[model samples]
Target: MDPQTDSQAADGGRVLIDHAHEGHFGARLRAAREARGYTIEACGQALRLPVRLIRQLEAGEYGGIDYQVYLSGYLTKYGRHVGVDEEAIQAELARLAPRQRQPDLVVTGGVSHSRYLLERYVTAATYVVLTAIIVVPMVWLGVRGTLDRDMPRLAPLDASPVAQQDAPATSSTSAAAVASATQPQAATPAETRPEDQQPVLASMAMFPPLDHSAARTPLATSAAAPAAAATGQGGHELTLNLPSASWVEVTDATGQRLEYGILPAGTQKSYHSDSTLDVRIGNAGGAQATLDGQAVQLDGFRRANVARFRVDIRDGKAAPVSY
Candidate 1:
């Protein structure tokens, strides 16, 4: 609703300088809120913003898609609350805010269905795969055991010795029993092959082969091993990008200064280290960070007014070091 203009003295009377630039919009907001005797909380309550975000805005910390794109509206609301010139604030912000926040939704929104499926199901499928690896082999082995112990072994009637053949003058029931003992029937086509001293169950090929050692590995355990390997020292890089202006500081574990400067809007900088990196950002709203080429959360940086944290890579494991 309202915004900012330069104030000055003309002919000993207070005058609002129309076209003058008042540097750091944050300072303008802070001065106006203070002049009204309103705490940051009271101003935020009136403006419907969290107290921390109000503090960040007053500190000139705006970053990220949410912050940068919506910041103009926030400024308008803030202007209304403080009774500044809305039109003037919008004009200044138009000149100040970069177009980086208006991300191309069409480009990023086109996520491949295959990739989406992989992301959703890959982890769950690992458990199923690991389970099948263990269970399938056990099932096949149990089947083999039943085939060996329960299934009758059959030999041709001619395979019997001459003495046993000559001694058979049995009754009809005994003859039928003898015939059954000599002849075996197969229940399924999988077991229909003749077994006359050939290899045990000539076709165990119906079941998939099992990898005993691989089956023993739990999916969680195997996945953890790779994560640890990823964390080891060497080739660790910390990158910071500021879509909007923010104050930042960085130091290494060896206490070597890397970056201790105010980042201008719409620029990026990086530092390399072998151990840990300590980072402090005065304005965290739109800051993005990467550690070892992986996106890492700024962890309460944006809303906290100022964010400070440490990143550590040890024994092939990368983790945040809490401050």
Candidate 2:
């Protein structure tokens, strides 16, 4: 850099002496010290300089302070306290200061402005990755929610009288039918059935007769076989007619029990019955039945006429139920 042209303009061409000339920064420093009535030693004490060095600086000698930075600091402090034109002096110093450019050296040492740019890019990429990590699962959950809304519901295992009774067969047959229906085949045009297509068989089938009353085989004591057990012998029989929104329970001497329910008018498969060794029914009403020749008690929370009955069996016949 060259000497400051601006200082020339500001100070009306009476530029402070440069430190390199015979009477430069030292002469100006000496003039400031003398004006303040500071001897060389007094100037050294004020600015923390050695008397010999201060004399050397006053003579405009070089190489006293190895670093120009220390000279600048010393000049700034002395100039400020002495009420010099600090700005003009600083401008002159800036013009005279050594250049600090190292752009080529930075590149040669395997570090460059490009490295700073790449680090910024990597930071941006990391932020994008973190945002993706946070968002993907939430998006997945949203899509899953939408899918669930559109999907058909699975029937519960204990849904109804018919559903509970046919649960295993229904599942197996449905799986087989699904498999068969999906088999690869030629497309066939829709065809009209004959006007006199034979009537399809009803799904109902006869319950195989029980050979012995005490038999515990599944075929003998299934939900379908309960009616047959009542028909044959050796078990108590009770009839309960439950009103809508009601339930019924029946317990035998052996602690074996059964429960039944009736739901609202529009609900499908609303009736339920299950066999249990002990039974209690709640949240139902309006029931009636005979129990060992006495009336069973009735209790309820909603609509009435629900029945609870216990049976007594002797010689394989239903005894009158009792409460």
Against the true structure, what is each candidate's TM-score? 0.27, 0.31
Q: Which stretches of model 1 miss by more than 4 angstroms? A: 1-234, 301-303
Off by over 4 Å in 2: 1-20, 24-45, 48-56, 59-221, 228-323
lDDT of 2 by residue, 1-323 (tens): 33456555677975554444435665777787778877877667877877787677567564557767766776677665555677656864664465223345443456689999999999999999999999999999999887755543321111134233343444565767576457635212111221122221111112223342232233212322223223112233344433332222344344544333222211222112222122233333344434334444544222122223334345654433334
Candidate 2, run of 10 with poorest lDDT: 186-195
- Sequence-dependent TM-score of model 1: 0.27
- Residue 18, candidate 2: Cα error in Å is 7.8
lDDT of 1 by residue, 1-323 (tens): 22332222333533343333434677888898889899987887877788887877677666532655577777778877987777657765664454434655564458899999998898899999999999999999999987765644321111112112222433356867666566656323323332232222111112224452342233213212211112223477677776654556677777875654444445466676677778887556668888767886876543345667888777876666667
Score residue 265 of candidate 1 by CA lDDT: 44
